[model samples]
Every structure is written in structure tokens, then in C-alpha cells.
Target chain A: MTTAAGSRTLAHPGLGEITLEGVLHAFADPMRMRVVRDLAREEGAELSCSYFALPVSKSTSTHHFRVLRENGVIRQIYRGTAKLSVLRRDDLDALFPGLLDTVLAAAARQAERRTAAGS
Target chain B: MTTAAGSRTLAHPGLGEITLEGVLHAFADPMRMRVVRDLAREEGAELSCSYFALPVSKSTSTHHFRVLRENGVIRQIYRGTAKLSVLRRDDLDALFPGLLDTVLAAAARQAERRTAAGS
Candidate 1:
């Protein structure tokens, strides 16, 4: 069913349908993990695809978003002419309880370590 | 590089060298995740490779174990004729705090939910 926001509808796995293996696999890729890290930092703010300045090509970015959406890590809905994405924090929190936060924190820690070492 | 336990040695990423992406990727596979879940439940108890009755062939099981070890999720060492595997709990806990526990708990919860639904 297409929402009023746009003509296209995205498929998202229900909270009950989300699996631990799916989530882990979705976040395994560096690009996908970066998308998740950004979403977590935004704290539930729904941002359009254009908001993420990923280094990859547009098609590659789309693939990454699709992976996240298919794995139930993020929910995507079209708003106006743009497709916005948001972390399924509520569903994930209910299902896994602190898993998202722990992973985000770990990613941040690792990034900080990399930055420090690089400097 | 050989120890008295056996004549062979395995390469494992050092604690500091382990990356968040690598850890997630290692746990992404169902077989690998099962191996990890079993290891976590044992709570630091080192078990030989033969202890795990994985449904896959010996080669596939070895590959999964290698992935886990190379990702720094588990430490493997030879003991006599058997190669024992143990979760690198201390290293993982130190690197990512409660990540391992949260994942393990999530897996357990999901398994319980599936069982309940199946019944």
C-alpha cells in the first residue's frame, strides 16, 4: 500500500519477524554499519537518503539501505519526493533490549580509536 | 610457534586488532553464531573441536571456527590431539563491554520465542 507521502511502499520485517542473525548480518558491512551509526546518533530522527553523505555511489548507497531495511534494522518511508530512513529503535529495543545501543557505542569507540591512532 | 599441546597453531587477531565490523561479520553466519552461542553458555570452559556436534561436515565446521578465531571472537589452542576452542570473553568484554552478553541473551530470547510459537 502506498502512503500519502509517496507512490512507493517499502517492505519492512515486523518486530516479531526480526532475527538476531539478520540484524548482525545487516550491520556486518562497513558501509551499512556507518549508516546505522549515523541513524543511532540521530536518536530516532528520520532523515532522507540525501542526508547521508556516504562515499559510495548512489546505487551502492541504495543497496546498503535496502540491506538495512530488509534486515529490519531500519524503516524506510517516502516523504514528499524523498525516501526517509529511521532506525527501528522501538522494535529492536523490545526484541533485543540494548543491543542497538551497545553496538552503536562499540562502533563509536572503535572509530575514536582509529582516529586517535591515525593522528 | 608450536606449543606442547600440539604441533599446529592457529592465527587469532589480537584483542586490540579486533574491529567491530569483523566481530559482527563473524557472528553473521548462523553456523558461526551457533558455535558462539554454545561457547558463551559454557562460560569460559574450553572445549575440544570434537565436542561440537555441528550438522555440517568437518571442513565446514573448521571454517566456521576459523572465522571465529580470526575475528577474535574465540581463541583456539591445541591440546594433545585435540584443538580446543574457548570464547575470548575477557577480550571481547574489554573491547566492547556488554556486546557479547547482549547478543547471547538476544539469541536465547529469540530461540525461546521460536520454541513457544512452534508449540
Candidate 2:
């Protein structure tokens, strides 16, 4: 909620303003979905931007995080030099019950299937 | 599966090839989501494209339908002059478990919330 010096404040859409289309668009990208999956796995844990080991450029990962934050999928807060992100699970569940969990489950299933096929 | 004369065959990604990203992108558009929701509600009923009372132009509707079909969300078959579409519920359920149902439920909840808020 509060920002420290040199850390920019990020604008996030309120729960009321978060539309289904916006959330779907945010998760449509592979990178963004990966970030969401990781956040979901971490649950209550707040992760900094550098925590995610995404196979993309730093700017690209930043873009994906911004997309997720702007769409109200995650809440990003500045913590000194680190910008921490936490999944907006409560807001999303309240608005669209079972959606976030279902997406996470699907992602997990897909990942397992991919790993199995690869092995 | 079969196409009639003058009707072009639409290319659809097979169940094995359908990625979560593609399905999410297909449903990210409001019009396409509406189409999928309707298809889900009807279940086994196959309806023609003209059956959907969308607010968009004919071309735009066609494009949305194409996106859904190409992403493996729905199966569009040429039934004479009408291109009938049916939700690929089985394929999706097998691949992603409860994803389609969850999305439909979320859409319904959001619509109800919007209506209640408006009233």
C-alpha cells in the first residue's frame, strides 16, 4: 500500500472494475500464465519480480507482470528495492468464485501432462 | 467434419495440439466468450452461426467464431447452408478437467453481478 523512495507506485484496477475479459486477456499470454501459476503455488507468500525464473528478457517479464497487475489478477507493492507481487486470490474468488483455483488446477494438470509426455 | 459445396473448411487445432494459451486467447474476447457460453448452455444442441444474436457485425461475428473453432474451443461443421457449432466439452474436459465449466460459471456470476449492480 505504501511506497518507499525511488520505487514507483503501480496502478491496479479495483475489484469492481476488473472485468472477466480483462482477466482472461491477461492470462492468455504464456508468460503471464506462468507468472500466475507461480503466484498461485506460493499462495500467501509475496514474491519479488526477480523471484520468477521466466525464460524471457527482463523487460518482457516486467511487461507480463504489469499485465497481470493491471488486470487485477495480482497486487504489486513496492518493498524497498524489491517490488513484491501477491495473487489477488480473495478479490478474484469473491468476484468469480472458483475461477482462480480452476485455472491453477488446469495449469498444473497441463504441466504434469507435458512432463509425462516428455519423459 | 464434412463440408458442403461453397463452404470453406475451417482448420481446428486437434485436442492434443490445443494449448491453454490458445483457448484463453480465444475466450478473451467478449463476443467469443458469449458464443462459447451459449454453446455450453445448449450442450448437445448444435446451432448455426446465425442463431447467435450478437451485437457485432456479421464479419466480426464470423471472426470470433473462427477464433473459437481454430482454438479447439468449439467444433464448427458445415451443415448445408448453415455452419453449425457445438462446444468441444469432452475434449476440453479431458484436457483441462473443469476449465470450461468453471469459465461458464464465472461468466454467469459476473453477468448476474452486473445486472444486480445496475438494478
Best by DockQ: 1
Poorest 10 consecutive residues of model 1 chain B by lDDT?
Answer: B1-10
Q: Which regions of candidate 1 are displaced past 4 Å?
A: A1-6, B1-6
| Clashing pairs for predicted structure model 2, backbone only | none
- Model 2 per-residue lDDT tens digits across residues A1-119: 55447457878899799999899999888788888888888888899989998999999888888888989999998878899999999999998888888888888888887999899
Q: TM-score of each model's B chain?
A: 0.92, 0.91
Computed on alpha carbons, the lDDT of every model, listed in order, comes to 0.90, 0.87
Candidate 2 per-residue C-alpha lDDT over B1-119 given as tens digits, one digit per residue, 9 for 90 to 100 = 55447457778788788888888899888888889988888888899999999998999899888888889999988867799999999999999888898889889988988999999
> How much is B27 displaced in model 1, in angstroms?
0.9
DockQ of each two-chain model: 0.88, 0.75
Which window of ten consecutive residues has the lowest lDDT sum in model 2 chain B? Answer: B1-10
Model 2 has an lDDT value of: 0.87
Please state the CAPRI-style docking class of candidate 2.
medium
lDDT score at residue B3, model 2, on the 0-100 scale: 45
Ten-residue stretch with the least lDDT total in model 2 chain A: A1-10
